[model samples]
Target chain A: MNPILHELKAKQWIWNASNSQGKGHSKRLTTGYEALDSVLSGGFPSAGMIHINSYLGCGELRLILSILRQMPQHEVAQANNKLRVFIAPPFQLNAEFLLDEKIALEHLLVIKPATQEEALWSAEQCAKSGVCEAVFLWQNQLKHTQIRKLELAALHGQCHCFWFDNNRQCMSNLPLTLSLLLSRENEQMQIKVNKQKVGWAKPAINIKLPFKSRTQLRFKEARKAVNNIVQLRATP
Target chain B: MQFDTCSLWIYLHFTQLHLNVIENTQVHDERELAQPRAIYNMQSNQLVQLNESALQKGIKHGMGLASASLLYPQLNVHEYNEEIEKHALEHMANALYLLSSDIVLMPPNGLVLRAQNMLKLYGGLGPYWQNISRCLSQLGYRYQSAAGFSIQACKVMAKCKQGIISQERDVIEQQLFKCSLAHCDIDLKDFEKLKRIGISTVDELSRVPLSQLANRISRYSVGIIAELRGQAPSKVTFFAPSISYEDYIELLYDISLVDKLVPVLKHALKKLETFLYVRNTQCLHIDVSFYQREHEPLQIGFDSAMAIYRHQDWLEIASLKLEQVRFASPVYALKLVCEKYEVAHASVDDFFTHKSTHIETMSLTSRLASKLGQQKITRLNFIDDFRPEKSTLALADIKSKSLNHAQSVFADRPGFLLETPTLLQQKIQLIKGPERMICGWWDDGVVTRDYYIGQSQQGQQMWVFKTPEKDWYLHGYFI
Candidate 1:
């Protein structure tokens, strides 16, 4: 090997194609959706940073809720039990929905920071604290350095952090465990793998969501109700 | 002398308490103590205490301030403050409380500890006094101490600068007898009368009969002599340490910036650490007050999610909080007060697991809350109500009511709720619902609506509701 190649290998900067096939299987956290799991090789990485780029109300949070609901509660005796922190969430998390999903309300913490800096600080702190199981941060934009810091913190704490960014159109070429782009089309959630640590980015996959829109039937029903009342008024 | 039966008491007399307090709190260098300084008594227009350099410059205690200033024109003089001295004495007693249990605080710089009880526990009086003197030396206060059978004898011996450290009654009595009558805490008129009678030393006073001495001096002076001789019991009140923690530091210079308050605040927090450690207790909340020069004192409060007693942790949290404060004026003093304390509980970590960082959840929450306001960090709670908005409680409004374990009658509810319902401008196709909720008739916030889970063309799921007046509003998001 050349000197430059040796140095790059030493720094772990060069990705070896052979190394991917060999012992590169990191622990995977099941994403609850079988099809989505199959498309991502297994599931989400157990620990480190994952960036999800999608618009709000596009089942982005629902995708995370499925993973959170299945995550094992942290049973460390000294630590708080399975704390899940949400930083800079745009809207209030509905306790009813959380309870219905069986996520413990007591272990849930939500931080609504006033500025982007504070939100980033809170996310890093929660991820590095080693007491939280997962940290979900919703921000408009984050610098590359901020994401790198959050990634290092997550690795140190053995926590999974989902960075939800809705503003960025294309993902930056940051070295993250996973970067996913989600969109809704044809009554299905389209998940595109933009980057992954261990494998090549896969093409987009569509997973039909559970919610079905029966718009025509409801519209006809409403119109019939209105028309029947009008016919009764005319006869009287 | 009944030395074995009677209790031995040690009296510590701080001769230059006010000056020592000022030096200990402010002087960062040992060379600062060599400066020519004196504490002037404003009432008497005389110097009450002098440092070695001031004494070398021909300044003496009780010398008129004008003469002292004339002798050393560049002398630094501070007016004697009785309140600061009293507080310093109490602070010393609080520090000494761990070594000795029975302490009597004599205000304006004096502490008398019952050494006899602690002697047996420490194996001997020598070791007990060694422990006490070590604590006192660490405090950096200049004091003279003497041990005797009675409090009055100890005070008189200490005031005379005997510096006796013996439990032997005969040795203490000999030192007490050599003390002059002027230092016996007697009245000025009694001292004058004693001078006329040629009883200048306590030995001569003790030689005279009590009945004769009673006629020459006041009854109080007679009682003092009797107490000094162990003939009458000395009524002493033992000092009880306060449960709550409070420590104040007067800065040498005015601190205009928040960063400059860190060192002084760290010192005060170290005191609190010891205060809590000695009692094996921790505090959840502490109030820090900054005494300003020209404005109302600024007060900032810090609270921990869990009871904590470590100074480093408190300092870290305090500095974070201090960054947010805008100082109105320069602060001259800082005080930390903690009214509530909880018993310190030992937290056990897993021995098998190898982790790089181990932070408690409560500590993390506290760290966040310290930086961000407390209202910013909150836990989610479910409320027992029929209305969708009322069913989920707002952030930080934690109520202790048992969560209604019963499953929701409606199955499809949105994951997130908006603060207020907005007009449903975008057309949304109904997915499910027509869940009618006609509750809250008694309360001011009534809800009579039909809720439906709807999806827009962008594949966005929204919770829209129609009120009785046929107005549609979006209330929540499925995501």
Candidate 2:
């Protein structure tokens, strides 16, 4: 076998194959997808600030929601007292959509900080308080010091902090535990792990919906159909 | 009138009664020694009450102060103030008023309450007892309790330090009979006479006929026997629930900083909590006024979006409001006035339980409203109209507002609509179309548009409309 292949197999075996009490994989919160979990060596890093850069309308929010949908049943059971905070989202987060996605609304808290400064402050407070298991912050711009403070806060509170921004230049500058870039191509989402806390880097993870061809729900008709579905599904 | 055997009367006996109050009065006092201490009543010149230490030391109540001092030379002695003791008991009764309205003041150091009616409200007697004990403990009272079907029975049982709860009249009578004559609150002269006659227990004294008992003691002895047998219909002044709550704390030292006022505020809040619990209400509006030597009282008032009953929640909001206050002068006192109150809903979650989404949202929005002004937190409200411009967002109110259920005559609206429709200048490919909507014909406003979901040359999905004049306008964008 090639030396690189042998090293990769050994690393994979240690983190993914082993379930014993050896010096195996460090605890990571699974992304609720087995394939993604295997590639990411269990899943996303549990502590420190993770920066995810995604193009507009690239299903970043959907990815975060899917991860949150797994929390109450999995990650939250370990630290049962923590809250999941969503701060300063770009648009109004429909609580109905969240509930339909199986995210526990009682454990979820949405805070709309009026300014970027307030958003940073609220994010740090939630992270540093140890009362929040995960803090999701959506801000397009931030200083290095702010990111450092947020990372320290996440470490202090033992929280999984996610910063969703589209600034690729700043993303490279920050010392994040895990950094990913999400983009859409040919009706599929490509999540590329640009940085990691440990192990060798892997190829981008591609996710394609199997039902899109059957519905022909793409583009303009898709938007209308989505709106109609949301209206029909959520009433009072 | 029929005797209600279902009534469960609760009696609270303060064991370290006066000492507990004195300790709380001395702010930040934490000396909790196990030394034997007695409170001497100046008028009676007797040791009126003592701690468990004194009881273990064989010191008894009503012992001469001189004899007690001579017996235990190193014993800690405290002067019992009648006024202070009455004030403390009234405060405790006011707190107990939350459990039931039938609170009877036993004066000096005890409270008699009718609790059977609210047993189910707190789940059961065990939980109710736990809640009452917790409340008293929070108020810094060292207390014991007893329960019975009658006021006199519970009081006598509490005085005898039996601490038994009995619903059956037979069991209560049996327990009352078992109490020693010295511990029973009978006439002292009659007590002495009964002892001389070898009647050491209540059963022995009850063996004497009413006429024989009256010969040796006052005729009140006959009433006592009737009460003990659950046969007397005694008059009790039922506690009236207060409509509002106001409590104050005089700081031991002048508080120059706002944070120092927290301890005093906490003490007053406990009183407010008890006050609200007894009334079964929540504070809707509260005012905290700070007083100084000569400065005009600075009052900070806030109204909650919903009735707030939790002490911690109330204190949290109060502290948030307090952060904005700068004391004009050195503060010596703080007064909490809850002028407006609303009967809280029965389904309110316990303090330790997770609050329902509605409450959590309301509290969060209310907090944000206070911090960022009410106008800042807005909610999208659907308006019944064909024009997309007419659909407005309003300031979110405290009450949960359901989305408008009025079915729109049109189909396929974009989530993000432009404030004003701009004339489309680019070539567009229509995917779905011709959903013609004609409305606003009345009141001098008329609109006729052929709406369609179109894709621009740049692949931007748009909600575009064509007017009767053949002019096209871009209305919204689909993400």
Candidate 3:
């Protein structure tokens, strides 16, 4: 076996997060496609992290749209969903697909910025809105600096960041907590976690489709045990 | 209405007048007549032929260069000299539109008018040949207008001007017996055959009776028979404008404390937004300039509203803009103005028709503002304009915060906030280091944020939305 493949196998065991303890956090946002979710720890979205890579053929977008398309809704008087999404200037959508999703068309909105400076400003503002759970940039391009600021915003607002692929140039050693590269195999999405903070990287994990909203997973990095159980056996 | 170039001062001086209109006048413009290419060689004088091949290839005289090439092969088209066509079509249409309100300008060299009404206006249009001659004199073009109640007669009147110039259909009735074959957009071939046999002209064609022609050449021939008799056709329908908007404001303010008067201003905004929603429109240029105030009153461009509407998704956007208020010392009066309006289909039954939860919420804000100071009111509007500070806004009198109740916490509301961290009261071990944040470059405030979902020694949970550009402010709490 190749040494790197063996190392990755060993890394996968440890990175497969087993513990679910702490406050509100999800393991990964199901990319809808089954093959893609396997690479993520579980079906959860991390608030402070960035999904930096994207794929072509609209397969990646189709995955997200399919999952979001199934999100439950009612009249405003009944209740509100805990999440919302924001896209920046010149960002466009297929009106036909959206209509097909049974996604409430009124919930969808567009923002046209007069300039790029305005686009960034709008992105940061949306992330802070509190109501919007995630902020996505249909970046014709992206810079490391922009990613870093967005990372901080995701942390500040406890918001998630999904970087859909564009004309973005690839780079290395980003400050992002988790960076995954999404590629296509047989028109199915594949997620490869290049980095992680809590555990080791795993084999490419494929998540399930029409991804149901599951935020029940949150795990803190392993901490030193506070209570040491002193084993005292009764002297018999 | 009467217009005359009859006054001396109104007569544009020769120096200031357009010289090209007078210069382009040719004594006998050959282009006006239908002549074959060989006719130029038979001319008594040497003639400069313009676009002889283009004409033969089917490029009409008045067609534009961009499209002329599509009709004619081997056509060398030139860019339009606006100065030339300006004299032709517009001068022609203006002369025609003066005849009636329902004039339609046909391409190149034709003018159509709904002259039925004009006959009465000009005392039966019989003596109007003088007016036609006078209008042509004012315009440099030498033109001939054929008047008739129907299109067939008008076309026949125009064609018969050269060899025989007689208005009487009875005299034309005699001459029609001598003419040869004819052709037009209509295949008047059968009618030409009938006319060549014994039915000499249109009068002779009409003499055949409607039912006989209907059977002879289809119902269209019957239509031409009616048209030849100078009868008016049925009116064509026109469409109504696709957009509709109506707005008005009522002011009942008697005293000033301009800041205190935010309600009246906000009501106008609510009314404006509702009106736009009904019409399905968006606003870019919005303004409300104060007409009267205490200490030299002020004006505000509706940019504040536009900013709020732009970033309506976020709640703080309009709030920040409204914070720029400079209330008058004795602020005595207020006015609300909607400067820009557009048509957008706002699903009205949801927000506008009656009070839905949104309206109930907006109304609640209005009530709250009425009870509380207007400055304290704001509305949580959802907008996709990416800027956070620009998303949510305080409608001067509109209330703030969503109408939604706080989520119960026996179980965690998956994404609700935890308590925000304040400055350290005591040292604590690190569960996580600060996650830094820096945003906002376009609007000038570069935020560098550091966030933590840290637990204190007591295990109380907190959610914080903070800015490194400013001190951390506690935003949410967990049960």
Question: Highest TM-score, which number?
Answer: 1
lDDT of 3 by residue, B1-479 (tens): 11121110000011101122322321125453233221111222221123444457665544444445466444432222333333345444444445445554443344444544444667654544456456556655434445443444454554444223234555544543332224222356666656655765544564566666655565665655554554425222211212322222223334354444455555445545544553456664455555454466565543322222322311122233445565555444334445555554445474433324343333222322222234432222323322233322223323222332212111121121212234444333333335454656666765555654433343323334346455554422221
Regions of candidate 1 where Cα sits further than 4 Å from its true position: A1-27, A30-41, A69-80, A212-236, B1-7, B28-38, B45-47, B50-77, B117-123, B211-214, B345-359, B395-406, B432-450, B466-471
Per-residue lDDT of B142-161 in model 1, one digit per residue for the tens? 99999888888889889889
Rank list by lDDT? 1, 2, 3
Model 3, runs deviating above 4 Å:
A1-35, A46-49, A69-86, A89-91, A140-145, A155-159, A167-169, A175-178, A201-236, B1-298, B303-479
In angstroms and one decimal each, the interface RMSD of every candidate reads 4.4, 7.0, 17.6
Task: Order the candidates by TM-score, highest first.
Answer: 1, 2, 3
Could you tell me how far off, in angstroms, the CA of residue A207 lies in candidate 1 after the best superposition?
2.4
Best by lDDT: 1
lDDT of 3 by residue, A2-115 (tens): 787789656432232444345234444554444544545454454654564653332455455454443232222124333344344222233323333333333333343445
| Residue-wise C-alpha lDDT for candidate 2, range A143-196, written one tens digit per residue | 778887998898887777899887766545455667787765544567777766
lDDT of each: 0.81, 0.68, 0.42
Listed in order, each prediction's TM-score against the native is: 0.84, 0.51, 0.30
Q: Give the better candidate number (1 or 2) by DockQ.
A: 1
